[model samples]
Target chain A: MEGLIDGVLPDAAELPGLVADLRTARSGISFVYDVIEKLAERYELSDAVMVLDHPELGRQAFRSARRPIGEASAMHLNVLECPEGVHGVPGGVDPVSASVAVELCRIALDLDLYRHDSRHDGLTGLYNRRFFDVMFRRCASQSARYGWSFSVVIFDIDSFKQLNDRFGHMLGDRVLQVVGAEMHHALRSSDVAGRVGGDEFAILLMRADRENVPAFMSRIRAAVEANMEMSVGFSFGIAEAPVESTDPAELYRLADARLMAAKGTKR
Target chain B: MSVPASSEEVRLAPLGDSGDEDESPPFDALELEIRRLPGVVAVGWHRGEAMRACLSVGGFGLSALRSRAVQLARGHLDEPLSVELSDVEGVFAASSVASVRIIDILVAGGEVEVRLGAGHLIGTGRAGTGPEGAALATIRALDDLGIGASIELRIASAVVLPSDLGLAVVVSVVDRHDGSEHRSIAYASSVEESAAKAVIEAYELIGEQSRDQAQSAIR
Candidate 1:
């Protein structure tokens, strides 16, 4: 694909530098930004946004080049081999830019899948323990920087071991997958939930404080219960990051302790 | 703004024919047939989920209309848009814009169906003057396996430096049938060169997958 503009699109003399600029972007979001910014300079369009489906995050979009007017007739962001939606700017992407965009969007999608795999559990496809660690630390750091607290809830399925022993491992696995799916469906996209250990899950509710943790947890627990339907139950303990403790480890420890206490109280 | 306008009557389904493979309707032919619809300019194939129509962008570009299209697609269709929009756009851009109607595609139970819009159209100002053809054709095409399928593609990281000397691109491609993935990271003196090298490497990996599939079929 050397001299992509020249070799592929002979007529598009104006697209080489723009494609190169798009190539300079290190990630999908930045790629969208680069496309917008460079396109504005090259094509005289103002503003641009690229929206695509992300595996774990669902839908994600980025803005950079800025916009023409709202009346600028809509054009397909057909720069790549993706089914991505576009916003901002008008007229249309030059053919060569469209080619480059197609490849870039395809790459962006691959990255989303890669990130999802690296972070998710194999069996249940939920965020894994390692992802939990990373996200927890990020939440704590954000709390420190933003002066707001996010809540961490660590919970375990009641009698998961008993279920495994009685129903065998396959049923146990199904239970885990079901619970994970339920949790994913019940939680917001920004809220990250992970399978931390056998039968244990952790959720980080962004911008949530201790005061609202109960309502979120209660609503989720009920929903999960109804979804699971075989008399399944989960017990969780919530703690505010940076509010209850500044350290992510410390916050997790506190949440774990409270989880144990909650389990005891139930018993 | 040519959102599929829903008509009073929807011929929902070649229903209750779950097990009748002999009842295989022309649904298998819908892939190519969909493109010939009154307004469908292009086609995108994807794994999982029903076909969702993103509203037409007309002659302009997608930057303005994408969000509203996504929002409407989600509300109108039960499944989210899994097919890549860029590809669809590319297909249309590569073709003639003679027809005006833009129709979204759907597949199920060995059948392909296109729904007319549910009243409102999405996008900024007025787009093409052509009418929607959701009513034109019901049959959409399927892949060779009589299923909708899309290959996995991804861009890892592609970066070009301000100095104009160092450039790098990392790409990954996975086979949708199998979970195997190929990753490549290349560094070069130019961004285009790096991207080309990365694509080559990923393509090499995908080639291996093709060979494997062929061998498995032979066995």
Candidate 2:
């Protein structure tokens, strides 16, 4: 591994395969860090960091940098367990160094952000439709493994178009922001809420029964109604995960159809 | 003996000056009377619509009352029913009707005044036609009765489907002064019913008031 790092930067084509090998080996965190550090040293790079998902410590990264004089500088990266990873450089560097370093850091950070964003809505910053698909499968798999149940709730703004017309687009944006915040506040930490479309949101309730859904939805509805601008309310449709459908896509379609049914009956 | 009895007829003065009075102050005799109506639970007054009242009733009659109120209002103001208006001018022209909902109920005297109004349309389903028809209907309804006149209808407690509980009773009254029309709807229901009924009754009350006023003026 040291010899591998001492050579030229891993070919762009080969880096993925090498990373896969490292992952498969279940390489120790220190070993991974050393590999990154040695590579940075060989390339005369400013810095390198290796992060791992640890059972007890969450995600922690060990970073090593090579000074212009070839001395080793090191730091420990501490971050929350949020789905996306955070990155920043400390102290001041010259503009050129800063630009290059920042761009490099962004490239690394973006890998994580993109992974999370793929599962989240860009505008509302809630979980995206893709996230729902992924979560359905993951949750179903977990439920099958654990012999538990999972449920989903599909909610959309009732007559949201009227709101945009009466209050204008800016207020409509405010409404979404307020709704997202309230929903986040309403759910347990274990639960997941994602914005799947312009006015559509979905929630994944772990270990939830069909009976528990109405109460959960009622709480969410009340919270949203109370927190939102005057007279705004939402309609929701709920479906249990494996019970509704084993397939993730089918589960979503079922939930969405139920939501449309609820909307149709509203006078 | 002839000087003992004076011929002068002493008439009681009206509560306030007839002109420029706050027609629907927060608390007044009429407001109190509305609150005391049969089945009424709460009453509020606003100058914009005037005499908003609410009532809670035992039974599906509320829907019938809603249609009847719209009909009676049309007789006086010549404005069509909300559904009819929606069809003719498109739903947006009569958008105000959809905004009304029953909020609460109050019973005062022997009259059962259903309180209605409050809430707004969730979205813009209609075009921009303004409130001409709604305004005209309100003016006509208010013009009909002499001073202290009131109307009552039986209302069934409303039930939002999929939910078992009865929500509330809703009603509205409209009156005219000069050329301007004043209309109000009151709701008499529990806190649970507040969100659904407030918007429905407001529109009904406005339409009813406009028609009543227009008819009275014609007479």
Candidate 3:
């Protein structure tokens, strides 16, 4: 009764199922659209606008109605921000169920955001160490079973400490971001990249031989050099699966050892 | 599979030292830290042996809090941990959360007895003298209100704040029944009052959680 007026709210009896459906939605976009679709069907809402500010996906709105925009009555434009407990719908409109749906959608979005954040690096938008390790093991097992070959590339920014000391962490982080963006852009969809350490990054190149990895790294290196404001440089090492070693740990070590050697040669 | 190792500069201590042989895992420390993260409300673990958790979250940094919780759990738990975080934005809002407050404190015969009240409900607890006793007494009083379970005191101390801030009491408590931990600090003229307030502050969320659970069950 607190949120109910003359507008349509989801029937009280159907809320549990609706909430369950929203909870199980695979992603935030699906969740928001599902709510809009449900509202349109249940309440026959002629016009509705649901805006979401997602952490990863940015700002998006899911709107559903039988007519064009700007025609919705003031009653239909009521916004529900659950965290602040503010309801903006005008009097004589029943938005109780819609408000609940919006709140549930927000919750689902938060869950999705956290789930994503948990697996990826905050600064670089690359896989975090935990998830990268997970993918590495999965790839290693599958490659061994199928007798396929893959490559692990381990690299770090050259003189990264000196760069951070001279430029401060802000610029240093920008360099990492640029490097990460380049890696993301240059890598094949099947490949996996992660920010493994402060300045260190690891890439699992699916179906790639050690010999072929240099070509991919070259592209990434060129992109980084072209995009970066400062003259940033990096060194890398690569190891192949089955040929070098199928063991995940051993492959990492092999790649890391080569990375250290490259750094030494650069010095 | 092993977690990818970070540089030594950013590496955390190993998780093997989470708890002692005779005690349970250090969920209290983990919970206290997780709660301090942005957008976290009440957090609790499942009742069984599994290292699963439920967190009530709101505001920004949901991902940071979720990721950090896993990282922190890895540091405190030996087993692989899974966290289930939900957005129960208004569930733990201050509007409904309630806890008993210290109405009176009496020390006699090297023991401390504290009286706490919320509305018409009055609860009393007694323990040996000192900050530890005061904290325990506060927990006992919460139990007497039918709002708390057996609590293990992880830390109870009085410390002087920096920059002439003044004296403060910090109390960390773990609920044995549910395996949730809470920590809070309070500044008071006397150590006894400070400890009591800190414990009371810590239990407010737990109290709200239990009340919500009971209400849900009733509904």
Interface RMSD of 2: 38.4
TM-score of 2: 0.37
TM for chain B in all models?
0.26, 0.20, 0.48
Could you arrange the candidates by TM-score from highest to lowest? Answer: 3, 1, 2
Residue B67 miss distance in model 1 (angstroms) = 18
- Per-candidate local distance difference test: 0.47, 0.39, 0.61
Please identify model 3 stretches exceeding 4 Å from their true place.
A1-14, A45-48, A52-60, A64-94, B1-219
Best lDDT goes to which candidate? 3
Model 3 local distance difference test score: 0.61
RMSD of model 3 against the true structure = 19.5
Rank candidates by DockQ, best first.
1, 3, 2
Please give the lDDT score at residue A4 for candidate 1. Answer: 49
Q: What value does the lDDT take at residue B194 in candidate 1?
A: 48
Q: DockQ for model 2? A: 0.01
Candidate 1 chain A lowest-lDDT run of ten: A63-72
Q: Which stretches of candidate 1 lie over 4 Å from their true place?
A: A1-101, A122-126, A142-147, A168-174, A181-190, A206-215, A264-267, B1-219
lDDT (Cα, tens digit) per residue for candidate 1, span A65-162: 21211212444542322235444355445555655554555454355335445766755556789977987777788788887668888988888999
* A130-185 per-residue lDDT for model 2 (tens digits): 65666667776776576567778888877889887776554565577566656655
